[model samples]
Target: MSSATVDTPEGGFEFIVHDDHHHDDGEHHHETGTMLGFWIYLMSDCLIFGILFAIYAVVGQNYAAGPAPVDLFELDKIAWATAWLLLSSITYGFSVIKMHENNKNMMMFWLLVTGIFGAAFLYLSVEEFMHLWHIGAGPGASAFLSAFWFLVGTHGVHVACGALWLVVLLVQVQIHGLTHENKRRILCLSLFWHFLDLIWIGVFSFVYLTGVLL
Candidate 1:
């Protein structure tokens, strides 16, 4: 019997549909939850980011004596940065899928691409911050600057850590293929990476777009 399929927005991808209506055969259904671990990690990350965001909301607009987002942030720079990070997510997806196929070389190639894009994203973050610092908008400048630093800086730090972790995992995967533990770790890291992308959307929309307009 042929299996069912689902339509994916990524251009007609195939997926198996579970038979919820029937259960038979000596089929040993394993309840191995990879998602639970990912959720826990996401929740913990939320706590970290939540605290930072609260700090920003508290002290974000104290532009008392310094330039605000309206003054230092540029649209073009953010657009490029967003592209880099978003593209990295796609590359990371390829790496994960390739790992599943046990195509070690292809996996490594995609991972290297992921790392490069991740690096570019981090570099752009540093440049943005450096530009602000050059314009005398340090933490000591004003509440707006401080909060801006706290929010954006916090996310940048996460991305930096993620990039570093990705590089290490690349070496580990190359040396040890995708062992069960490594697979789990990679899956969790994928969740981490994608979650950061979601948060970045929030950062861009709230911190940049809204901040500039309103």
Candidate 2:
């Protein structure tokens, strides 16, 4: 029996072929690497937040002749902002479900709803900051206010970024439908949105609620 042969650098040799299964394995590895990298990034972010929280804990009571949390923090407003953010997480979850179902329209609608809720959260947060500024409670006024603004403002910025990301993803979904790449993107966004919600819960409990009590 004759067999196929190929030329090597030095001589001819029998050709050896492998199945295409390794290609699928390589792709799976790539996907896992992507998720792992994102997770590592999130952990670094947690460290940043942890340091901020530690700083706040150290100087959160230094009023420097300024208003304290009791005077400046509004529970009602915080509650509303929390509700909006939490609801946005829920809507994002729905969007992910719709994506899994391959229902592009429903996914887009849920993403829009999530964005609106995120916007509401950011608006409420900005309003609270503005009210503080108008009342002479700006970050420069005291260490406590500075820490408060830095921590809360950082979270607000993240939400704003997430909202923008959602908009871009929505446009991509419209243009490309829910391709495998898009689904992966949506899943990553879902992780990020839920992570924010978890962080906000911590903010509400540790910052807002605890501040009011203190």
Candidate 3:
């Protein structure tokens, strides 16, 4: 008889499963290790964002006698985009809850809803960027515009990546059902999605809101 080590889905231990349908003592350490590695990756991302924020703080006022944030930013439009992003995070939470319940259909439904909201956010953000470019308030216009676009545009790219990942995950779940690997992938993506939401909060506060107010 042959045996292989497999991590259990719910805990921090690994167990051995045999070819002949026999199981033995083990623990689920793999999942825990994976989560820790992901946390480290997220910390690295934090460092990147921190650098961008510092750069923006330094150069955000150097408008080169060009348009400032107040002249370019439409607060109402940004507010609506923010609403869509926040709502997407909430819907992703619902999907996670459904995953925990092992309700695949409801989970997929909520995940799809989340994707829609994310798409709406991206649409509004792109529209805002297009408007700015059309009005000659683009990144090359000034140091202020450069920093603004770099920071916000980087975040927008991340959101776009996440949205794409969501679509791939949806198709994976549909084809494979809620297997253990699928569930683990979902959990990872959940963390990623919520992390984006938190970062967006910082962007909204430090960049958009303050850009308008101060």
Candidate 4:
């Protein structure tokens, strides 16, 4: 009689069946490890933002050029900007659900929508900055302006980065299908996208709205 040995990649035992049965230990451990590593990386990123936010809070009101946030920001435009980011986050949620279902086209479509909305938000935000700059309230004008620039610019940079990442992930998904690694990448990107939305909500209420109305 001859014996058959199964490979586990790291050189280990695998279950073999006499019938036409297939069994492989799912890469659940690898998936879990990837998720944990992603979370740790995200938390470390969060700490860096936490410091920036604290600095903004401390020096956020120093408007040396006589142009306060209320004077420079327009609520209607800010509202539209907020809607854009919120929509992008919702679209990304759809993408993740579709990814879980292994519906590649649906996932890609939703991700495209997400990226479009994200880009729109960035466009609107840049327009808003331009509007402010035209009114003589650019970054160098005041500490208040500087803080605003620092905070809002930080978030915009993040959005741009996220959009770029979505492009990369879209390509990866196209190449790999809904693989374990690809799925983990999607999961991490989803988290990053939603986290940006959460922070933008803070930016809207505390930064834009308060600066405008209060």
lDDT against the true structure, per candidate, is 0.78, 0.81, 0.85, 0.78
Residue 130 C-alpha lDDT in model 2: 90
The residue pairs in collision within model 4 are: 62-144
> Compared with the true structure, what per-residue lDDT tens digits does model 3 show for residues 1-214?
2333444445323322321233232222235655677788878888889999999999998989998888888889889988999999999999989988889999999999999999999999999999999999888999988998999999999899999999999999998888766777788888888888889998989988999887
List TM-score per model, in order: 0.81, 0.86, 0.87, 0.83
**What's the lDDT for candidate 1?**
0.78
lDDT of 4 by residue, 1-214 (tens): 1124443322122212211132244533434445677788878867867776777788788776488777777888888888898898889999988987889999999999999999999899888888888878888888878888888899899989999999998898787677655776788888888888888887887787777665
The digit string of per-residue lDDT tens for model 1 on 113-211 reads 988998998888998888888878887888877778888888999999888888888888878777544665677788889899989998898789878
Highest lDDT model number: 3
The residue-by-residue lDDT of candidate 2 on 1-214, one tens digit each, is 2223322322112211221222346323335544677788878888878888888899998989878888888899899998998899888899988887889999999999999999999899989989989989988999998998998888888888888999999998898788656776788788888888888887898889999888
For model 1, the run of ten residues with the poorest summed lDDT:
11-20
Better of 2 and 3 by TM-score: 3
In model 1, which regions exceed 4 Å deviation? 1-35
- Candidate 1 at 43: error in angstroms? 1.0
Off by more than 4 A, model 3:
1-30
